[model samples]
Target: MAKVSNILFVHGAWANSSAWEKVLPLIGAAGLTGTAVSLSLTSLADDVATVKRAIALIDGPLLLVGHSYGGSVITEAGSDPKVAGLVYVAAFAPDVGESAGSLGAGGPPTRLLEVVRPDEHHFFKLTREGVDEVFAQDLTATERAMIFATQNPLAGAALGGEVTAPAWKEKPSWYLLASEDHTIHPELQKKMAARIGATTVTVEASHVAMLSQPDAVAKLIVQAAA
Candidate 1:
């Protein structure tokens, strides 16, 4: 049987599968099948399970892609035997016993805290300014507005869910470092990428690099798929 050429995507906090809209077509045009999973954003376990379920549906080897907190999801879920590789786009790649929240303690701080507001529940929502200035600064006004309006509240406690085993430890990985990212901090991206020993590519974009530089993002994903 021919290889399925599957590429599965997992989005980050405050984002849904739609966030990969710009790049999915590019992957399709490259003769690859790309599917983005909609995560619950309720907790890491739920998100990881969502990714694993998606992985189970594919019959061949697949590349697992993640952005932002979605990186954490793929790092945990990418351990499946079917996962061939991992691509991280301006995302967090935590190690064993490190949660996304704990890994950043005393490291370079990000502007994410600037606009993050907590709800009555444990969820966190970014303000309009956060979307416009910190998260998707390189996007157009309409794009920024759409992101601000549609963002899902991320369960704050999800950041604290530690990883028992990091898939990056075994999987070949690629990392796209967004230089102008205020949300995750470029310095931290470099550190995580280095720690995971990923094939690193730097792009002059914001936290949402996939939106601002879809060509570059797609190129890296295609490379990882290869």
Candidate 2:
């Protein structure tokens, strides 16, 4: 049987598998399997299960990558015995006792979050204008609008749940820090990366570094897998 080096990409809230449209191919070219997971941002448990479902399909060494809230998901999911490494792209790198909701609360509120309004369903979504200016500013106007129109609404409750296991503590870890990130403070990302003792790569870009700086992001993943 051929050896397979699989990589799983987990996307953050307000986004889906589409977030990795440009990233997946780069991962494949690097000689690793790439799987972008569309998480249920509504529930932490569901998202973990979704990650597990994706992991079950892998038959070889794996690198699990997650962005934003997806970081929390991969932290838990990467605990799977098969996962060989982890890459966090401007994503939450929460500890075992911490949750995304709690960590985000300590920081100065992000402008992108100011427009989020809860619906009767208790899900939160960024306003159209906020998505354009705050969330996807690096992307073209057309791309931003398309993402804004189809963005996933995440449940506020999901961020409040703590991770049962933090994969970075056990696995070799890499973090891509977005210097110009408007969503999570770069300072906070630095602190998180420090806590995990991760090999950090700083990009002069926004929160969506994987999208805006795909080449750099891909290089990091390739380096980790290599």
Candidate 3:
């Protein structure tokens, strides 16, 4: 196995780098260095660029770990030569010509979809109720509140942006499925994981599994790094 000394964490929509606060130390405890990128969430292209820039800063083999929309970012950025592997934590792994929106097109609309509200600029954010009831149900009341307050709204158009290529097509990948996720359906997660031929492990948690089950999520990241 390649020696992966660094891991870059890409957060999903409605979140910032703080989303990985609890998981970073755990990853470090496993003898690996981890950094979470705070995406602009302005556009898919921009997000991918942000990840690529982060990759350029690291010197050795690195693992890319993405959650939710961050998965889409890694799928696009993982093609870089420095990336050693990918870890998808309840995220979308879209292929070439597919956008995050298109991947979930036929699936039943989730409560999250119904609760998202767009600003005048077309950026989307989840309602507080959506955060508490759907997105992070497994988290505590205070934690959910903090998540709702600190969410970084994502541009609505980003969801429809298509990927030019998916890194998972060429790299070793692992997926940690949140079985109780209400945002991204579990079936969709299973399908994406299988499609990518990712080694998968399912956790009985909600959409924000990294926050709710950091240990389990970190464990898989360490395994991928190893």
Q: Which candidate is the best by TM-score?
A: 3
**Model 3, residue 191: C-alpha shift (Å):** 0.3
lDDT of 1 by residue, 27-139 (tens): 99999999999999998999999999999999789999999999999999989999988999998999888888876564598777889899899799999999989899999
22 Cα displacement, candidate 2 (Å): 0.7
Q: How many residue pairs clash in each candidate?
A: 1, 2, 0
TM-score rank order: 3, 1, 2
Which digits, one per residue and each the tens of the lDDT, describe model 2 over residues 42-143? 888889999999899888778889998898898888888888888999988888788888777776667866867789989998888777667767888888
Off by over 4 Å in 1: 1-4
Worst 10-residue lDDT window for candidate 3 reads 106-115
Error of 2 at 45 (Å): 1.0
What TM-score quantifies how close candidate 2 is to the native fold? 0.95
Candidate 2, residue 137: CA error in Å?
Answer: 1.3
Clashes of 3: 0
